[model samples]
Target: MTDSTPSLDLLLAGYVLNTLSQEEAALLEQYLAADPTLQERIDQLQATLEAAYATPEVKPPPQLRMAILAATEALPSQQTEALPSQQTEALPSQQTEALPSQQEAEPASWARRLPAWQLAFGLAAAIAIAWLGIDNYRLRLAKETAPTEIATETPASESLDYALQPVEADLTAAAQIELNPAELEGELTVAGLPPLPPEQVYVLWTILAPDAPFTADSKGAILTETFNTNAQGNVTESLVLPEAYQTLAQVAAIGITVESADAPQAHQGSPILLTDL
Candidate 1:
């Protein structure tokens, strides 16, 4: 509370609204005590504030009237519960005392139901704030996980899948590969094949015909791509098809050969895995 007239008016407004904390109220009280004119202004402001709240223009929810009545009915019972019988009896008589001057609550409401209306508003405000906080938190969580959800639901429609046919029999060591023909891209997934030596890389070849003459020194047949197997003889690898074949499925046969990686373009080893497109 300041000594100036404008500050006094603001202090009176806060006092009328019952919004001041104990420390602030104490400061205002001290200021008011020294000036009789300020005390008169406070009384006037309080009357105006009460009138404003009571007017038809300031309509509270109809439930608020019910809350006011309920609060008035429960006041005596709440006062009894505020001092538990067992706790009151346990406290030594000498320690019991009136509320100290500094700890004093605001003066009792002149209009008893006015405080009830104020209490109902406070409870409604607290509930609204809590609901808003929870809603914002949930929205934030959804935003953070949005990318992962979209990725999980997305279908890989651009890629074409080809099931490899084993040349000799229905072998379990064969790998399934998916290809995107437009990009000349391939992903080979190998499982159950015995892991070969690191020096021998697995080479995939695309041949022009089933019985086509082929060799490292030969022309026409091309080595599509090469990769190594993992510790479990399982490997999933991405490969690019040769420029001669935009789609590897266009070729007659696909074969995997255990060969030295030093000669990527040549086939110097016997075929270990053979399949048709």
Candidate 2:
């Protein structure tokens, strides 16, 4: 209906096949009125089909002809022998009544007569399958309604709080650190601090005691995280602490300082905020 060339071609194919519905025929006629070249294409298609049909027919091989003939000859005898019982079933009511005793003497071959052992085995198998199905359904139902026990972990032990005192008295910027000794994890909350430029970030440092059984940088500090404060100059961050924090004596102190974002671990700056572990 939209006059698309492919759609018109499809309608033309259906027309050639004599398969187009009445509505499709009318639609194609509308297109044909607007496009006279479509008629030439139709004539070319019909001529090609006629040329193909004009090709002389070739006979099948003699052996194939013989095979088909042999199959046809044997079909009637097979049907007659296989369905003798069907003939009796089609008998008139008068004939059936007259030959009642004869019919009883010659039971229909189509009705299978299973042996006693076979019948018993089949019945036992059916019972077993039914029992298994019922048992499976009950098991599934029980699982659906059964209460489930979830293993809940004990809450993390209480954390120790340490206040980070600002070195510059005039600056009211301060922070608090909460360390979970057992879990070796902590949170740092900073307030009243000013945001740094993109190239600079705030870094947290954990300094260890001289004789502690843990590694540290040249300045005896273990760098934790490098972060930037938001426009409000406030940020809360979770950090993983060193194992030495479990024994407060092993950790000397924790601190925060401004550092180059490119190399925060270099520890080039001194602490502006410090907290004794």
Candidate 3:
């Protein structure tokens, strides 16, 4: 291959790491498409990369360097010491002649005779570099593909506040109801109302509009809650409105009536305090 063209292994590594330039990636794709079997190698590399990433790094023991060095330093002397005995065992003329020829045939480069530890360290360093490359490449790809969230201010819920009007203009009783349509909840605040006896209680009612959906009550009034006033004839109660309360369009009005505490849903009495929606 020309100097400009990367070897197959280099191209595969670059492709797996996603570090290939446009032209290099195109070249690799062409080769991969031509040989469909190359996909298996790609998958293997991907799996290996994932495994390496999932593996936790472990530090070498402190004595590892000393052990490796000691072994390497002792190798030459141990080999030299064995040479005389080896020569004696090969005393036959033919065998001795073959030993010298074998030694001569071996590579003369010092790199070929490098200590095992040095070769292993070089390989470990290369793998570490490859892992780092893959990790960084994956992080960059994630950042590029990740969806960005836009900050938005949510509009506040629509709150409906109504004042309860006493049935008799001379009555000093006052009350108010605040409803949150979004949450389908409301609060009832009342003061100066006359306290009822044990047999009677104040029943809140929701009067449905004429076009409201079918309800259990034929009178179009939903019995909301039954509450008792304090000794001081004042009460503040948090009320959970029904789903129908979400839209006032379905409600004709809100009212409070003095009903029999045993059966508040009977709604036998007229509204003592009422508010038209």
Candidate 4:
């Protein structure tokens, strides 16, 4: 479609053989419109062909004619016997050379028939299946390890059931303590305590004699073991009276203290919450 010259070999063959298709002829005509070089080459080839055919034809000499005539007369008996013998002798050598080539070509021809894209797709699918299997295995291992982590890290005595109970200090600042006559067990609910620091907890204490508590050591006796507040700053726990004070219990109090997680010693930290029960 551009102004490039058409192929000279195609043009030469088509012109000599007179076998140009319609499209090829049109292309050659388009090139001739602008390509003077191609036109000159075509003209020169035509002139050379014409000059070759126009050259004189030479006649054979009389002796050469006599020699050809004698050879032609002897050819019939030679063809009847000699040609068959030569052909029979050449057949086995031809077959021997061709058999190995045919065998070698069979495997190569079948190799071309194999589907390259299908093999690539099967490999990709196998890789995807292996990756998914590994991912599922890791997920199952994480699921099995979660409960063990929770059991080891969480406190043993903390009540999971009363996790939502409100604290008593914020409920009533001066609530009176009422002794339970039937049994020496009671529940303590305290709320609005500030969130406990890390490795610190709150302990419930009983004031034995409010009028006689005068020293730091005799301020109050610990009633129940200490426990950490939940993240919501509420403490709810059960209290059991000490055997010595089972009948003589006067007042129960709740106090918040910062203490170590293991073998808590005493209320050594600042008290942020306090209430009489």
Candidate 5:
């Protein structure tokens, strides 16, 4: 709605905050009486405001209320005389006759008639309070309904299989790999290998059955994981496969490659030990 149009939202907000002029409050009450949607919105706002204040509330010190009351009493009174009461139609100085009073009188024109400064101050105060309440409500909600982090536990290995034996022409190594299908983890232990420079490491490669969304080289190869051997020329590692590569059952072959430390993720070196499933 345009700013010029009277807003049901403004009326609803003021009603919830108890700051509406009597006329606006009455109008809002009448609107809500007939509109369930509007009533729901107002109720939701009121519930949020209540939830924000309900918890983490501490009572003020015993004397705080009394002191505040005393201070307010001591202050000079501003003329509570309402703004020029709504214009009254002039009747004959002496009415020819009296009419019976009706059940309700038209409400006096409110806030619209207040001085400019009073209107501005009231608006500023209301905005500040509303912003504060909204911020607090959000913080409380975040604290109570935060996402929980789930932890994956390692599964027990069913068996350790010496799957691949390196050829003597390249380097002597014994490869025993433990498979934990439940956790999608593999523990690879390579012994009898000679460790030389710090800039080199062993890379494990696997050939998956060519039916997945995985990127492979011309030789249909995918890097499983990489590990650096310890100073004793031996390496043991528990490798974890990402969700996409967890299709271990679909792997056709497992192999090991000697890759330089600076080698790109795409494997170019040939396998030192390779064996088909």
Candidate 6:
């Protein structure tokens, strides 16, 4: 039969979370198998759900798991009483006692229940909880594994000015710098560069030659007037020199310097950023 029902967001949510009945689930599965769009929607919903789960799991207190288990164990005894005969036979006395109170109080009601359906719902809930728990554990694990020195983009940009200005070394640690491939023929975008002091501004340098002690003056070529940042704090200018800088076999590295705004001078301030290009 053609599906005459309108697309239901809640139904889709139920399907992704595996809360649908077998018939409902089977219908959804069949529809998804035949419809690529529906399948994609389901995938997107699942990804979103997983991501949501990850956020909450990152710092779940130790008591959350115990609470979930406690709630699951508290399901109406009427709901769980009629466990399969085999389960009843195999269960220890302690285990039977620990079964939800509803199970004991409504044994007869449970005895008439269908094992498959009950098991399905139980399994679904268990799987959901497990997914949530594991996702949370993994998030916490990732946070723990991350290096402390790594600067995140959002946090670094909050208080900084984006105008053509000098930034301090303390602030540079939190500023991100971008390079357009078309504007600067270089690899690796340097993020989190701070501004220079009032009398000093930043100059981008290309080290075309590597001298013995590796002084900035020993570098063969200089990239000029190519540094710019926008209000949103993105680097819009090019620090790359002409094509000649690319041919030098011994180019040491790329370096940023603090210099007087209008003189043929080179004073080594704190290296704001550096990379081999």
Candidate 6: where are CA atoms >4 Å away?
Answer: 1-191, 196-198, 211-221, 224-234, 264-267
What's the lDDT for candidate 5? 0.61
- The better-scoring model by lDDT among 4 and 6 is 6
Specify the poorest-scoring 10-residue window by lDDT in model 3: 147-156
110-198 per-residue lDDT for model 4 (tens digits): 21222444323323333344444455567689999998887676433233212222243453221122233235555666555565676
- Model 1: what TM-score? 0.36
Instruction: Return the lDDT, model 5, position 118.
Output: 56
For each candidate in the order shown, give its overall lDDT on alpha carbons. 0.61, 0.71, 0.71, 0.48, 0.61, 0.50
How do the predictions measure up, each by TM-score? 0.36, 0.43, 0.44, 0.29, 0.39, 0.27
Stretches > 4 Å off in candidate 3: 1-156
lDDT of 4 at 238: 62
Output the worst ten-in-a-row residue range by lDDT, candidate 2.
Answer: 103-112
Q: Show model 5 residue runs off by greater than 4 Å.
A: 1-162, 168-170, 242-249
For model 4, state the Cα shift of residue 16 in Å: 99
Where does candidate 6 have its weakest 10-residue lDDT segment?
156-165
Instruction: Indicate whether candidate 1 or candidate 4 has the larger TM-score.
Output: 1
How many angstroms is residue 136 displaced in model 2 relative to the true structure, after the best TM-score fit?
A: 53
* Alpha carbon lDDT at 178, candidate 4: 28
The C-alpha local distance difference test score for the whole of candidate 3 amounts to 0.71
How many residue pairs clash in each candidate at the backbone level?
0, 0, 0, 6, 0, 14
Q: Give candidate 3's error at residue 145 in angstroms.
A: 26
For candidate 3, write residues 53-124 as lDDT tens digits. Answer: 665674445555565555566656644553355655758877666664422332121223445565444345
